[model samples]
Target: MKVLIIKTSSLGDIIHANSIISDLRRNHADAEIHWLVEESFSSLLNLFPIQKTIVSKFRSWKKNLFKKNSYSEFFQLKHLINKENYDFVIDLQGLIRTGIMCRSLNSFGFNKNSIKESFASYFYKNTIGVEKKIHAINRNRLLVAKSMNYEIDQNNISFSYNFKKDQTDPNSIVFISGTSNDQKKWPLEYWIKLAGLFERNNYKIFLPWGSVKEYEECLTIYDQTTNCEILEKMNIDQLAKKIASTRFAIGVDTGLTHLASSLDIPTIGIYTFSNPDLTGVKNTKTPAFNMGSLSNIPLPEEIFIKFNDLA
Candidate 1:
C-alpha cells in the first residue's frame, strides 16, 4: 500500500503526528509511506523511516500569493502529489488550509466535532472521530488506527526514529529557553538561577535559540551562568541531533522540548500559560515530565529538584 501523510506546519503539532509513523510501519509492513511537511520542517523528517519527504512552502506562498513564482510552485507540488497515486492520504493537520490540500486525494481526517475548524472535515473522504481531551499524540495515533481499520496496542505506542545518538554526555543538560509565545516563557531570572544550580554541580548547560530575540535571551543566560554555552544557530535537524546527545532537557512549553522527549531523552516541560494536559509531551521512550499549568509557572528550584531526582 502507498500512504501519504499530510501534517503541513508547526513544529510541535508535526512532532505529535510523527508518533504514528511507527504504527503505520508496524501494521502495514510492506506499505510505502510518504510525508508532506512545511519546507522549514522538512529536514526533521530525515529522522523518520519515510520513503519520501514532500516539501510545501505554504508559509512563503501565503505571503506571496499573487506572485507568479508562488503559483508555479503550488502547481509543481500539486503535480508531484498527483503523480504519486497514493492509496491513502491522511491529513493529521485539521486546518482549513490542510483540508483544501486533501481535496484531490482519497483522504481521511478528524470529524467535524473533533477538530478546531469543523469546516475542514467536509473535505475529507472519511472523517474519524476521536476524543478532544486526549493527549495530541494519542489523538493522532487513534485517528490513524480508526481510519486504517487497525487496533493500537496501547502498551506499545512508539516514537521510532532512524538516527542514533552520535555521542551522549551524562553531565550535559540542554536548556530550551525560547518559545513562540512570550507568555509561555519562564522568566529570565528563573533560567539564570536554574543554570547556576546546574553549574555549581559541574553540569554543562547547552542553550539553543531560533530567532534573534531568543538568541539574545540565551546570551543573557550564558553571561550570567558559569557553565552555560550558547549553541550556534541551527536548523531543526541539526538541533535534534544535538539534543539527542544531552543527558536531560528542561524548557518552557516549546516544540524542541517535545522533540527532546520524542528522542527518548528525559525532558521536563515548564508550562507558564498553557495547560499540559491538552498538549504536553507524551508516549516517549524515556521519562517525560510536564510541570506547571495555566497561570501557574514552575519555580527554578522545583525543576532543579526534579532534575536531581532523575539524576
Candidate 2:
C-alpha cells in the first residue's frame, strides 16, 4: 500500500506525529509510507524510517499568494503529489491548507479540536473523532489507528528513529532555552541557578540557540556558568544528533523538548504558560517530566528535584 501523510510545520506537532508513523508501520509492515513536510522542517524526516518524503514551502508560499513563482511552485507540488496516486493520505496537521489539498486526494484526519479549524474536518473522507484534552501524540496515534482499523496500545506508545546514539560527554546535559514565544521562556535567572547546581556536581551544560535574541541569552548563561558551552548555530539534523547523544535535557515549551522526548532522552519539559496535561512530554522509553502550567510557575528548587530524580 502507498500511504501519504501530510503533517507540515510546527516542530512540536511534527514530533507528536512520530507515534502515528510507528503505529502505521507496525500495522502495515509492507506499506510504503511517504511524509509531506514543510521545507524548513524536512530535516526531521531524516531520522524517521519512512519510504519517501515530499517537501513543500507552504509557509513561505502562503505569503506570496499570487506571484508567478509561487503559483509555479504550488502546481509543481500538486503535480508531484498526484504522480504518486497514494492509497491513503492522512492529514495530521488539520488545517485549511491541508484540507484543500485533500480535494484532489482521498485523505483521513482527526476530528475537530480546540484550536483546529472546524471546517478542516469536512474535507476528510474518513475522520477519527478524539477527545480534545488528550495529549497531542495520543490524538495523532488514535487517528491513524482508527483509520487503519487497528487497536492502539495507549501505554505502548513509541517513536521509531534510525539515528544511532553518538558518543557525548558523560557529565553533559543539553539546556534548551529557545522558544518561539517569549512568554513560554523559563527565566534566565532560574536557568543560571539550575546551571550552578549542575556545575557543583561537575557536569557540563550545552546551550543551543536559534534566534539572535536567544543566542544573546545563551551567551549570558554561558558567561555566568563555570562549565557551560554555547553551541554553534546548527540545523535540525545537527540539533537532533546532539539531543540524541546528550545525557539529559531540560527545556521550556519548545519543539526541541519534544524532539528530545521522542529520541528517548531523559527530558524535562518546563511549562510556564502552556498546559502540561495536553502537551507534556510523554516518553515511555525514557524518564520524562513536565513541570508547571498556565499561571503556575515552577520554582528553581522544584525543577532541581525533578532533574535530580531523572539523573
Candidate 3:
C-alpha cells in the first residue's frame, strides 16, 4: 500500500509523529510511506522508512504569497501530489495549511490532537479523534492505529531512529538550553550551577546551540564553567546522530530536548512557563524526567539527584 503522511514544521511534533511510522511499518512492512513536511524539517523524516518527502516551505509562502515564483512553486507541489496518487494520505498536522494540503490531495485520514485547529477537520474524509490528556506520542499512535484500522500495542511503543552511538565520552551529559521562547529558557545561572554539580560528579557537559543568541549564551556558560564545551551549530541530522550516543541529556523545552528523549536516552526535560503534561518528554526506554513549572523553578540539586537516582 502507498501511504502519505502530512506533518509539517516544528521539530518536536515531527518527532512525536515518528511513532506512527513505527506502528505503520510493523503492520505494513512493505508499504511505501511518504511524508509531507516543511522544508526546514524535511531532513528529520530521512531517519524513518519514508520513501519520499514532499517539501512545503510554508514560512516562505506566507511571507511572499503574491510573488509569481511562490505561486508557481505552490501549484507545482499540488500537481506533484496529484501525480503520485497515494492510496492513503494522513494529515497529522491539522492546521489550515495542512488542511489545505489534504484538500488538494485526496486525503484519507486526519488527526485531531489537543492543539489542532477545529476548522482543519472540515477537509478530512476520515477524522480521527484523540483524547486530549494523553502524551503527544500516544496521541499520534492512537490516531494512526484507528485511522489505519489496526491496533497499536501501547506497551511496545518505540521511537525509531537511524543513529549509531559513537560519542567516545562515557560520562558526557548533554545540556540543551536553547529554546525559541525566552520564558522557557532555564536561567543561565542555574545552568552554570548545574554544570558545577555535574563536574563534581565527574561528567563532561556538552552544550548544543542552533541560533547565534543560543551560541553566544552557550559560549558564556562554557567560559564560566570547567569541562563545559559548546558544540558548533549542527543541522538536524548531525545533531540527532550525536545525541543518540550521548550518555544523558538535560534540556529545557526545546526540539533537541524532545529529540534526545525520543532516542530513548536518559533525557531530562525542564519545563518553565509551560505545562509538561501536554508536551513533556514521553517516549524513552531509559529514565526520562520532566521537571519544573512557571512559578516553580527546579533546583540544581534536585536535577542532579534525579539524574543520579533515575538515570
Q: Tell me the whole-model lDDT of each prediction, alpha carbons only.
A: 0.88, 0.86, 0.83
Number of colliding residue pairs in each model: 0, 0, 0
Candidate 3 RMSD to the correct structure: 1.8
Q: Which ten residues in a row have the lowest lDDT in candidate 3?
A: 106-115
Off by over 4 Å in 1: none
- Model 3: residues with Cα > 4 Å off, grouped in runs: 104-115
Q: Rank the candidates by lDDT, best first.
A: 1, 2, 3
Each candidate structure's TM-score, on Cα atoms with residue i matched to residue i, is 0.96, 0.96, 0.94
* Least well predicted 10-residue stretch by lDDT in candidate 2: 107-116
| Pairs of residues at least 3 apart in sequence or in different chains that clash in candidate 2 | none
Q: Candidate 2 on 1-311: residue-level lDDT in tens?
A: 99888889798889989888778878899889999999999987998899999998888888998888988898788788878998888888888777767655777887665336978888878777888888988888877787778999888879888878888667889999999898899899999999998888899889998889999999899888888998899998789998788899999989999999899889999999888888899889889899988788888788888988887
Question: Once superposed on the true structure, which residue ranges of model 2 sit more than 4 Å away at CA?
Answer: 112-115
